[model samples]
Target: MAAGIQQQNAAEDIVIAGAGLAGLAVALGLHRKGVRSVVLESSPERRTSGFAFFTWTNAFRALDALGVGDKMRGRHLQLQGLRVMASSTGEIAREMDLRVNGKLGPHEVRCVQRNVLLQALEEELPPGTVRYSSKIVSIDDQDGAKILHLADDSTLRAKVLIGCDGINSVVAKWLGLAKPSESGRTATRGYARYPEGHGFEPKILQFVGEGFRAGLVPWSDTDVYWFFTWSPAPSPDANGKEDRSAAAMNQFVLTKMRGAKVGPEVLEAVERSEMSDVLAAPLRFRSPLSLLFASISKGNVCVAGDALHPTTPDLAQGACTALEDGVVLARCLGAGAERGFGHEEGEDRPCLGDAIVGAGDGEERERVVAALRRYAGMRRWRSAQVIAASYAVGFVQESDHTVVSFVRDKLLSGVLAKTLLMMPDYDCGKL
Candidate 1:
C-alpha cells in the first residue's frame, strides 16, 4: 500500500521481480530485442539448491531464440527417449522416443543442472542487471507506472512490471491471482556422483510402483540424477515437516526404495549420493480451469513462469513452458516498441527508457496494455493444456484405488507414446 508519492525522476522501462530461470530468461530475451530491465532477487547471492531437470525440444528452441542454445547443448547430457518400467517386476512398460524424425533430423532432450542453467543465463546479462537481496515488500499502480516498495524501504518505479516469481509469488497476490494448491504428493530428488564412472545408458529410466514412482537419468559419465515421488497418508501433518537432518533425509529415501525392482546400478548411485545433495518437497500445481479463467495482466503489469501457470512435474513441462513465456513476452514487447508505443519518431534509442516512458500519456499506456494482452492471449490456451495434462497424469500415477492403478498400468501405458507425440511444438518466431 505504498502510494501517494510522485517524484520527478525517470524510472526503468521494465522491472522484473525474482531472479529465477523465468526472470533471467525474460531479461536476456529483452536484451536481445534492444531493451533493458532490472531484476530483483530476494536471495543474498546466487541460488544453488535444486537438482537437474529435463529440457525438451521446445525448451531448446526457446534457448536458441535467446541465443544460448549451442552453449547449453554442449554442456549437458542428451538422451534419446524415456523408458517406463514396472517397479514390481522391472519389466518395460512403455518407451517415449523424443528424437526428431524425417527432415527435422536429430532433436534431443537433455538434463541440465539447475544451477548451471541459472549461471548460464546470469552470465549472458550485462553487469548490474540483477540486484540481489532486494526483496519486494509491496507494489502500487499509479499514474501509468508500477511503484515497487523494497524490503529495505527503498522504491523503484517502472513503465512495465513482470512477475517471474515462482508459485509463492507476491506479485501474483497483488494481482488477485489464486494461490497454488498441493498435488497431494511429495517428491525427493538428488544427484549421485561417482568418482570413477557410472556405465548407464543415455535414457531416462522410470519405475512406477504401487502408489509411488521413481526415475533416474544419467547426467554425465560420473553423475546421475534421481527422483522418488509418493502420496503420504491423509492427515493434518500429511505435508510433513522441514528442518530434517541430512542423515535423516537419506535414511528416509533408502527406506522408501526398499524392495523395489530398481536395478543395482540405480541403488548404488543412490547410496553414493551425498546427504547434502538430497532435497524433498511436496508437489503443488494450479488447476487448468483457474489458469484459463484468471486474468494474467492488469494494465502493463503481468506475470510469467509459475506465477502464471504452475503445473505438476508429471510431464516435466513446468520450466519449459516458463522459458517459452519469457521469449513470447519479449517478442510482444519488442513489436510494441517498433510500433512507437513510447518513443518519438526518429529517436536514437539506447535503452528501454527511450522506447517507453514511465509516465506516458493515455494513448501510450493503452498501447502497452495491448501488447501485454497479446502475450496473455498467446500463452493462455497452450498453458492450460499442459496444466490439465500434468494434473491428469499425476492423478493416474498416484492413485491408491485398484481400478485406477490397473487402468494406468495397462491401458495408459500403451497410449503414452501417442499422447506425448500430440503435444504442441513451439517456435518463438524471430525476435
Candidate 2:
C-alpha cells in the first residue's frame, strides 16, 4: 500500500454479479443494512421486457423490509382461488378458496411485470452503485483475497463474494458444486393481450392433457401470463434458446388435445398467439446438498441466489428466495462489521481501490465460513421443501396415464388445490 494510492473500502467493495431480481433485491437489502454494494450486470443495459411475477404475502413482507412495497400499489390482482378443469370435459373440477387462506396475513398477492419491479429496485440503490456492461470472466480466491477477473482484464477483491450470477454461474462451478440437473421437458412462457371479443373472468387457471399442460395466470384486465410445458421434447433451437415458436408449440399441443374437451375460448386464445411474443427455456435445478455447505466462504468466497439454488419455476419461488438471500446476506455483513469481523488477521482488510484483500488463511477463514454455513443452513431446508412440492405439482399436472390422471384429476386435485392456497410461511422473505 503506497502513499497517494487509493485503498479498498469494504463498505463499497461488495460486488454482486447479474442484475436480475435476485441481484437487485440483495442490493436493496444491503442498502437497508447500511452496507454499500456495487452491482455488476453483464447486460449492455437494463431490461424491461420480462414477463409477469406473482408475490405472495411472505415475499411482500420481505420487500417491505427492503423499503419498496409502496410502489406495488394498484399492481396486484387479488387471487380469489385456483381453478382446475377437466381435460376431457372442460368442466371445473376443483377450486381452492383463498379467502380463508388470508388469515395468515393480507392474502392479496401482487402481480407485476418483472421489469417494473427491477426498475423499482434500481431506483432504491444509491446512484452509480451498479456497473452495467462489466462481465465477469473468472473469480479466484487465492493468496488470501477473493479476486474477480473481469473479461476486460481488470480485477476486484473483497472480504466475501456473493454469487447471484444465476443458473450458469461461473462462480458456483469454480467452487466445485455439481451443475444443475435439466428436467427433461421444455417450458415456454408468454403474455396474451385481451384483444377484442374476448371475455373471461380473472382467475388462476390450469388445463392438463396427455404429454403437455398449460397454465394461465391473470395479472390484470389487460393481460394474461401463460406458459406450457411438454415432454419428449425437441432439442434447443440453433441459438440454444427455448423453442419460442409459439405457433409450433401451441399447434403441437392443440393436436395432442384435438377432439378433447376444453373451453373454446382457451383454445382460441392459444391459436391466435403469434410467434414474436413467446419466450422459451429448458428447466434446471441444482442437486440439493444434504447439508448446507459447511462454508459458503471457502477462504474468501461465498455464493447466493441461483448460484446456490437454481429452483424450477414450477414453484414460482425463484425471485422470492433470492430476495430473502439478499436481505439475509446484507444483514449478516452489516451486523458482522459491528462485531469487528471485517478484517483479515495480520494484514489490514483491503479497501475499494486497493489490490484484493484476503479473509486470511486460518482463523479468519473459519470464521467467515462458519457465518456462511449458518446462512445456508438457515435457508437450505426451506428451499428444499419448496422445490419438492413444486416437482409434485408438475407431476400431477403432467401425468398422462388414464388411471393415474383420473385419480389425480378427481381425487388429488381437490386436496392439492386447497393446500397451495394455505401454505403459509412458504416464503422466508421475512428474514
Candidate 3:
C-alpha cells in the first residue's frame, strides 16, 4: 500500500506484460503523457537484482524524456571514457573518450545500477500501476481488444497491448515472431567492492584475450562492475560442455583470466567475487533481417523491449534500448491508450487523435492500430541495427583467429575507437 506497486482487480485498459526495465519505463512514460497502463510482473514482488550497465547518451535522453534523469544522475558516476587492453601484455589496444560534444550536445555516459534504475521508474507511478504475480499465459484478439488470459485463470481485456515480456515472451510467440537464436559466445557479469576505495580512475578498463574478452567499470566510490565474455570451445560430447553452475562459472573466469596472463590487479575483481555474484549465460539475439518483415503488431497488440528486439550486450545497449523503447512507445501511443479515440483530420501529433470520440469501429481501431504501427515502424530499423552491430562487434572482438587478431589489433584499432564514440550519438528523440 505504501508503494505504487499493486494487484490488478479487473480488466485493464492498457496492459503491458513484464514489469522489467521496458515494461515499467513504458508504463511510466505513458503516465507522463496522461495515458494509464498496468504492468504485469510474473514475479511475486518487484525483482531488483541486476548488474550495472553503461548508460550512454541515448539512454540519458530517454531517461530525461521519462522525467527520471536526475534520480539516476545523482546515483552513478560519469565515466570519462574507456581503455581496451590487450590481455597478454596489458597494453592498451584502443582508448576512446566519451566526452564528445556532438549531435545531441555533450555526451553523458555512466555505469548505472540496474536495480536503482528500475526502482526510480516504479516510484513515479500511482498505486496498482504494476500487478506482480501476474503472468500472461495466452493471448487472442477479439473485435478490437486483445484478451489476455492470466496464469491465475483470470482475464484482462486490453484496448492496447504491448509485449515488453523478454526473450521467451508469450506475446511475441502469439505474434509468431521467430525465437531468438543463441550466439556462440557466453558472458559472466558481477560486481566487486573495495571499501577503502578501488583507487581506479573514472573510466572503463577492458581486456581482450584470444576468444575471451572482459571489462570493468567503476561506478561508485566503493563498487566496481565487471563482465567477461568468451566463445566456449565446441565440445564433441554433451558431458564436455561448460558447467552452468554459479560456483563453476566463477572458477572458470578466474582460470581463464590467469591463463590469459591478465594483470593480477585487473583479475582481482573476479577472484574477489562471491560465488553467487558471478553469473554466466550464452548470448542470444534475434536475426536482424527477420525483423524487417516481422509481425510486431497485429491490430492493437504489439511488442517492445526484448520482446521486440533482444540485442547482444556487446554495445552495452540492452537496457539503454529498452529505455528508448518506453519513451518512443508512449510518445507514439499519444493518448491513443484509450480506445475510440482517433486523431482529428490531418493532425500530425497524437493524443487520442485530436480527442475524436464516438468514432466508428474502424476509426477507433485505425487510431490504435496506427499508433502501434508508428511505434513499431519507428523502432524497427533502430533495433535491427543494434542487433546486427552488437553481434558484429562481439564477433570481431572475441575472434581468436590469427588473421582476425592482426586485422583487429593493427588495421582496425582506430575504427574500433571511433565506432564506440559514434554508437551513443543516436538520439531517441523527444516525448
Candidate 4:
C-alpha cells in the first residue's frame, strides 16, 4: 500500500505479523531506530469493537520507552487506586493507594477503550506500513532470514520475522517453538458506556464472591470496561454465572449483578451495547521454558510479543509485556548485542551484520538456533515470574481455599499492592 511496504522481494528489511498492540509497537520501535518494517494483520482492519482495557504505570513505563506515553495519558482516566472486595459479601478486602508507589505520574493506573488504544497505535505507524486482511499461513526459514507465506498465496520476506500473533499463534509452531498449554479457567471481557449516576467511583472496582470474580474498570468519564471470570456452570440451564454460550453468558451476568452495586443502569448499558459476540475462551500459557521459540534469532529471523510469551489476563500485563519485548528485541539487534552464551563484542561478531548477510542454509539454521537459545535464556525466567504473580493475583482475588483466601485478601492486600505498584522501577527496560 505504501512505498517500500510491498511483499514482492525477499530482501525487504523487516516483516511483522499481527498488527495488534504488540505488532504495532514493534513497528513503531523499528521506525524509531530508522529501520523500515511492514506489519501484516489478520484482522481485516483495526478492530473498532471490543471491551475496555487496563494500563498500569508499569505498562505506562513501557509506553514511555516507546515515546507514546503522553498521548495515552491524555486519553485515559487515571485510576486513583485498586479496590479489591469480597464478591459474595461485597466487603472491602483491600485498598492499595496509587500515591504509595510514586511510579504513576500523579495517578496510579489508567483504563482506556481497547479500540482507542489500538487506534492510537495505528496512527503512529507510517501510512500503508500495516497490511490488513493479510493472514500469515506459513513461515519458512531461509538461510539468513524468514519467508512469510500469506493466506492469499502472496509471500513476503524480511531479514527478521516476528510473530506478534496472539495466544493461538501459528508462527510459534511454524518456527518450532513449544505449543500452548491448557489454562485452567476461562475469561469473558466486554465493554459498555458508563451511564449517568452509575454510583461507581472511577476506580478499578472488583467483586469476588464464592466461586467467581468480576472486575469493573472505568475507561473514560462516560464508559467502563468490565469482565467476569468464573468456573463453568454445573448445569446447562442458562442463568449467566459460568458457561460462555450467548444465552448462558447473558443469564450468568444477569443473575450475578442482579442485586449487586452494578446498578440497573449499568446492566441496561451492558445489554444494549453488544451481546451476540464475546471474547470467551479457556486461558492458556506456554510451558515455563528457557525461551518461547527454539531461538530468539535464527540468523536474521526472530519472534516477538505473544508469539513469544502468551500470558494470562489476570495480571493485565500481557499487552504491556509484549510491547516491552518488541522494544527490547529490536534494541538488542540494533545494538549488535546478544545475551547468554558468553556472546562478547568483537570486531567480526556473528550477531552483527556479517552473520545476517553471509548466512547460508546450514549456517543460517545454526545461527537461528543459537539466537533462539539466547533469547530464551534472556527472557524465560522474567516471563515466568510475571505469570506466577498473575496466578497469585487470581488466587488472592478469587481463591476457593478459605484460609488462604482470607490471608491473601486481608493480610496481603494493602502492603503487598503498594510494593508491587513500585515494581515498575526495576530495570526491565533497555537491552
- TM-score: which candidate is best? 3
Q: Mind sharing the TM-score for model 2?
A: 0.84
TM-score of each: 0.90, 0.84, 0.91, 0.82
* Model 4 Cα lDDT, one tens digit per residue, 126-165: 7788888888787776655667777777777656667788
RMSD in order of candidates: 4.1, 5.4, 4.2, 5.5
Clashing pairs in 3: 342-353, 343-353
- Candidate 3 lDDT by residue in tens digits, 198-297: 9888898888757888988898989999898998642333777657777777777888888875767667887777777877778899999999899888
Off by over 4 Å in 1: 1-10, 100-106, 233-245, 341-347, 350-360
lDDT-superior candidate, 3 or 4: 3
- Segments in model 4 whose C-alpha atoms lie over 4 Å from true places: 1-10, 102-107, 195-199, 233-243, 257-273, 276-278, 289-296, 337-378, 414-427
Put the candidates in lDDT order, highest first.
3, 1, 2, 4
**Candidate closer to the true structure by lDDT (higher is better), 2 or 4:** 2
Q: Where does candidate 2 clash, by residue pair?
A: 8-351, 8-352, 9-351, 9-352, 144-358, 145-358
Best by lDDT: 3
Q: Candidate 1 lDDT (Cα, whole model)?
A: 0.77
Task: Give candidate 2 misplaced runs (Cα > 4 Å).
Answer: 1-12, 195-199, 234-247, 253-259, 271-274, 289-299, 340-368, 422-424, 427-431
